[model samples]
Target: MKVSTHQPSGLSAPGLPSPSLFSSLLFSPSLFRPYLWLAAALVASPLLFSSPALAHHFADLGQMKPTLSNGVLSGLAHPLLGPDHLLFLLALSLVALQCRWGWALGLLLVGLLGGAAGLAWPGLPGAEALVACTLVVEALVLLRRLPPVLLLPAIALHGYVLSVPVFGWSTMPVAAYGAGLLLSQGSLLLVALWLLRPIAKRLSPANLRWLALALAACGTTWAFSAWAG
Candidate 1:
C-alpha cells in the first residue's frame, strides 16, 4: 500500500497554520481598533491613581500658610507642583503659544478667574464627584483629540475643587498657606517644564488623556473623602 502525505486544510499551502482565534483577534488591525482605545484607557488608568503616591506630601503641604497674595502665588504655582496638573497645563500652554504671549496670559487669566470662583464659593456637595467627572471628561477630550479650549475650563475646576475648605480654615495664616501652595506648585511646574520639554511632541497624543484620567481619578477620591466627612 502506498501512503500519501497530506497537509491540513486549515493552513496555507506553505504549512502556516490558519490564524488561530488568539492570533486573529490579537493581530488583526481591524479587530484591534476598539481595543486600542480600551488599551489606551487601561495603560493610562494608573495615572488616575498617581496622586495617592504623593498624597502624603499634599497633606504635608496642607500645613503651610494661606494668604490672598500667597493664594495668588499658589494659583500661579499650582500648575507647577503636581505632574497631573503640570501635564494638563503644559499640554494646553503648548497650544496657547500659537495665539501669542498676550493670549497665553489671557489663558492664565481665564484660569485665575475660574479658580477664584472655586475658592470663594461655599463647598458644593459631591464636589469630589464633580472632580471625578471633570477628570473623566478631560480624559475623554483626549480620547477624542479635543482642542486646548477644553483645558482652560479643566484648570479652573481643578483650582476650585481643590480649594474647598477641608477643615482648618482658621489656624493657619491664609497668606502662609497661599504662599506655600505657590512655592510647592511652582517648584513642581518648573520640573515638569524640564521633563516635559523633551518628550512632549512624542507624548502629546496620549498625555492629555493620561493626565485627564489621572486628574479625574484623584478628583473622585478627594470628592469622596470630602463628601464622606
Candidate 2:
C-alpha cells in the first residue's frame, strides 16, 4: 500500500510536472520553503563554528601569564607560550616557505638572535612596534606573492622587539638563553613548514589581493592595539 505524501514540488513524483514547469502556477513563497531553510542553515553553520572563538596559536596553555620556573631554560621558553610571539613567529616561518630553505632558516635564526641581542642590550626604542609592523609587512608580501627576505638589519631589529618583557622577566642572563631559544624557534619553523605545504597548493593568484587586504586589516588592528597601550 502506498501512502500519498505531499513532497515539495520539484521533489514530487508521477504525472505532476516538475515544480519549475508549473512555476507560473506555484508562485507561493511556501513552495520554496525547503530551499530557503537549507540556505539559512548553511549560512548559520559557519556562525556556530564562529562562537566561543577559536584560540590563537599560543593561547591555550596560560601563555600570556608569566612562567614561574625561575631558571634560564624557562626564561628562554617563555616566548613559546606568548600567543603574540608564537603567531608572529609561525607567520614568519610559514610565509618564508616561499623562499629557499637556507634563506628561510637563515632569516629565522637571524631574527631570533636579533631579538635576543636587543634584550641583552637595551639601547633601541619601539621594539614591540617593529615586531607588530613586521607581521603586517610580511602579510602584504604574502598577498603579493613576493619573496620573504631577512635583511641583516631587520634581524637585528627583531631581537630588540623580543627583548621587551611585559613585566620583570628582564633580569635573566641573555647569552645563556640563546641556545634554548634556538631550540624553541626551531620547533616553530618545523610546524610552519608543515602547515604551509597545503596552503601553497590551495592559494591562487586571483585571491591574493583580497587575502592581503584581510591580513593587512588584521595586522593594523593588532598593531594599533599594541601601540595604543
Candidate 3:
C-alpha cells in the first residue's frame, strides 16, 4: 500500500509554526517599525527639548542680582536648558566612552578653565557662533570623520558659553556658579556614559552613523541661525 506523503492542511507539526507563517513573520516590515519610530524619536529629541527663545537662562539670573542660590541654580540649569550645550555634552560623553578616563578628566579641567577665562574676559566676540560650530565638530567626531581630540576645543567653547550669564557675578557667587555648573555637567557626562555603554554595544555602526548625521544637521541649522541672527 502506498503511504500518503503530504501533511494535513491548516496544521503545523507539534510545537512549531507553519513554514509560511514563520517566513512571513520573519520578513515582515512591520516587525521593525517600532524600532524605526524609536530611532526617529531619538533623532528628533534635541529639537523637541530645545526652546524657541534664544536665551538659555531659565530664571533670568542675568538681570537679577546674583546670589549664591540663584548662581548655583543658573549654573545647573544652563547646560540642561540650552540645546546647543546639551547636545555638545552628549556628544562628548559618546567620545568619552571610547577614550581613557584621564582624557575625559583633562577635557573637564579644560572646560572649567575656559569658564574661568570667560568670566575674566566677558563678551568674547562670536562666542555663540563658536559654540554652535563645536556642535558640528562633535557630530563629525561621532561619525568618526574627525579625531576624538577635536572635541577638546569644542568643549572649551561650550565652557565659555556656559559662563556667559554669570559674567558679572561677585566672587563668591561666581565660585558657587562654577561649582554648580561643574557638578551638573559632570553628572550628566557620567550618567550618559553609563547609560550609553550598553546601548552603544548593541547598536550597529550604521545606526551610530545615522545618529551622528542627525546631530550634524542640527548643529548646522543652529550655526546658521546664530550667524544670521
Task: Please name the candidate that would achieve the greatest lDDT relative to the true structure.
Answer: 3
How would you encode candidate 2's per-residue C-alpha lDDT over 1-229 as one tens digit per residue?
9998976644446875443443333233576767765785685344223311122212124454433343245435655654445555665664566666566667657766676675567656545555556656767666644445533455456555555542234344443444455667777677566655555555566655655564455556555655665
Model 2 worst lDDT run, 10 consecutive residues? 51-60
After best superposition, candidate 1 residue 154: deviation in angstroms?
1.9
Lowest lDDT 10-residue stretch of candidate 3: 18-27
Candidate 2 accuracy as lDDT: 0.53
lDDT of 1 by residue, 32-83 (tens): 6688669967865665545522432242365655445444454444444444
Q: 18-113 in candidate 3: lDDT tens per residue? A: 444533433357867567678768866757444323655554644657889987887787778787877777877777777774577578778888
**How accurate locally is residue 145 in candidate 1, as Cα lDDT from 0 to 100?**
50
How accurate locally is residue 59 in candidate 2, as Cα lDDT from 0 to 100? 18
**Each model's TM-score, in the order given?**
0.47, 0.57, 0.77
Candidate 1 vs candidate 2, lDDT winner: 2
Which regions of candidate 2 are displaced past 4 Å?
A: 1-72, 145-147, 150-155, 165-173, 206-211
Ranking by lDDT: 3, 2, 1
In candidate 1, position 84 carries an lDDT of 52
Kindly provide the TM-score of model 1 when superposed on the true structure, using C-alpha atoms: 0.47
* Order by TM-score, highest first: 3, 2, 1
RMSD of 3: 10.8
* lDDT (CA) per prediction: 0.50, 0.53, 0.73
